[model samples]
Target: MEGIEGGGIGGYWWWAAASSAQLAWGINFYRKGYAGDSRFMPLKAFAVASLFVGATASAAVGILRASGVHSVEDAKEVGASIRSGLGIPRRARDE
Candidate 1:
């Protein structure tokens, strides 16, 4: 999938979260591969990637929905607490 562009705050956070997840999965798969009962496969990898994307999108959407936010700016405000908690840099959410 096309990732967010220009390394916006949200985009950067998404990359961090997704990359971390992918890295963890890679480690898990490597370990499993050495275990002889590995279930790591291309389809499983795809599924994991899909799940990560879905989760990130859902989280952003959910924050927006929960806060009655209808725009990027609104999303920024709504995501403030979370973004701060995650140590993501603050930026104007408005495009």
Candidate 2:
């Protein structure tokens, strides 16, 4: 556990790739699934992608904030961005 040195930052890249893949899959699934077959699969894939993106952004923000690199306003902006980007309700702001 001391000399291990292959899982530092590359893990982020894998998540990114998987997220993108899920997003694409969702879109394609939705498009081809418009024939009224199964609607849940597309939504599931899309939600998974959104979750990954949101989680990554949140983690980054936390890391930055903890290191004295970001301000409170940044967190608010990120929250707003995530909500708007995901087409979520905008009236749920805490401020």
Candidate 3:
């Protein structure tokens, strides 16, 4: 999909910014929960992990878009390359 422009913080940058904000919020909540009580620890931990994963994925997409990897195929290739670099095995896919 084409990125939205003209307005402030439009396009892929928006995703990155939002993701960063979410990560920050998650961390804050996690710290607060950790310091306050042990009952909410699991929920807080889950939130932090979820946000972190979202941020990572969003960052990757932002980087790919910024690098001119517009097509879906190109994005997939880039993801595969990253996975390979991280020693993650690729699953078989029907072309």
In order of appearance, the predictions have TM-scores of: 0.35, 0.35, 0.55
Q: Per-residue CA lDDT of candidate 1, range 1-95, in tens?
A: 33332223443455456556655765665455543334656666676667666556656654444445667776667678788899987777535
Tens digits of lDDT, candidate 3, 9-77: 346777779778877877777666566478877876887889888878887777766676778887788
Q: What stretches of model 1 exceed 4 Å from their correct place?
A: 1-40, 72-95
Local distance difference test values of all predictions, in order = 0.57, 0.57, 0.73
Query: lDDT score of model 3?
Result: 0.73
Q: How many angstroms is residue 94 displaced in model 1 relative to the true structure, after the best TM-score fit?
A: 10
In candidate 1, list every pair of residues with a backbone clash: none
* TM match of model 2 to true structure: 0.35
Worst 10 residues of 3 by lDDT: 1-10
Summed backbone clashes in each candidate are: 0, 0, 0
Question: Model 3, 56: alpha-carbon shift in Å?
Answer: 0.9
Clashing pairs in 2: none
Whose lDDT is greatest here? Answer: 3
